[model samples]
Target: MVVTMLRLRKAVTNLTQPQFIEGYRKAQLIDVREPKDFEAGHILGARNIPYSQFRQRFKEIRPDKPVYLYDQNGGKSARAALFLRKKGYGQLFHLQGGFRLWTGKVKSK
Candidate 1:
């Protein structure tokens, strides 16, 4: 049997809040922000992988679908994306501007 390798591309270079919100259900959103920041606010259904624990929990993430990583400022998410790539997670993507630019409702504390 032959195996196929799946590759994921950054469809949107600068993803906006509305765009992300619209694709929320269709994508696997991962929030790489710190606990406090994530607790303060985040897009709906986004999983908190916190950069600190991301490497350790990488296996928990599903590689079959597109992964959307985001942080408070986008930088951390970028780093997380790189980490995922290094770990052979080709189907990885990150929110262009992180949660700061997301216009969706945030979870209450």
Candidate 2:
């Protein structure tokens, strides 16, 4: 991602699966994995904003709403949260274990 904004060390909330499932309906659920990974299987209703495309597509996610993010593991989502926080996004949350550990329903193409 481009480094055009201030790099802030803002803390993003890490949610367990139960907590994530509880609030994701009211937030923007973003899957930060690559498209292929997203296409294979992802949380139901999640929007794809792959880490590779985050710099260009992040604006598509509303900064006003809470954002819930995840990747194959927690790493990419954590990075995406850092990037989004730098861009002035305040309400950030990520699945603690990410998609690989998600026990909820998923959508596969």
Candidate 3:
């Protein structure tokens, strides 16, 4: 497994919206946005574990599958990815361009 911090270019990441959506049912799709931002709108099926609480709640996240994170602008999600890496999360991915670039049919309730 990846045991060290690896910086990946957003373009090089092997994650796509369709792939993420399909994998959502089988993997963990986490929204690292604030509670208020999450309440506003977020990807369907995404669980809120705001960035602030992620470190403390790391144990709650599964390490066996990929974890996808997305924020309003992508910055927070990237931060989440970095945090996860430092926490030994090997399978982490950030939504390219974040939720703002999501044009899929999935909607937040």
TM-score of each: 0.78, 0.90, 0.78
lDDT of 1: 0.71
Which residue pairs in candidate 2 have backbone atoms (N, alpha carbon, C) closer than 3 angstroms, thus clashing? Answer: none
User: Candidate 1, residues 20-106: lDDT per residue as tens digits?
Assistant: 666667878888878888888877788888899988988888777777778887777776776777776665656666776666777
- What lDDT does each candidate get? 0.71, 0.89, 0.73
The better-scoring model by lDDT among 1 and 3 is 3
lDDT of 2 at 86: 81
RMSD of each predicted structure: 6.9, 4.2, 4.5
Error of 2 at 45 (Å): 0.4
Best by lDDT: 2
Candidate 3 local lDDT, 12-98, one digit each (tens) = 243667776766667788888888888888887888999889779877888778787788777777777777776777877767777
Model 2: lDDT equals: 0.89
Give the least accurate 10-residue stretch of model 3, judged by summed lDDT.
Answer: 3-12
Q: List the lowest-lDDT window of 10 residues for candidate 2.
A: 1-10
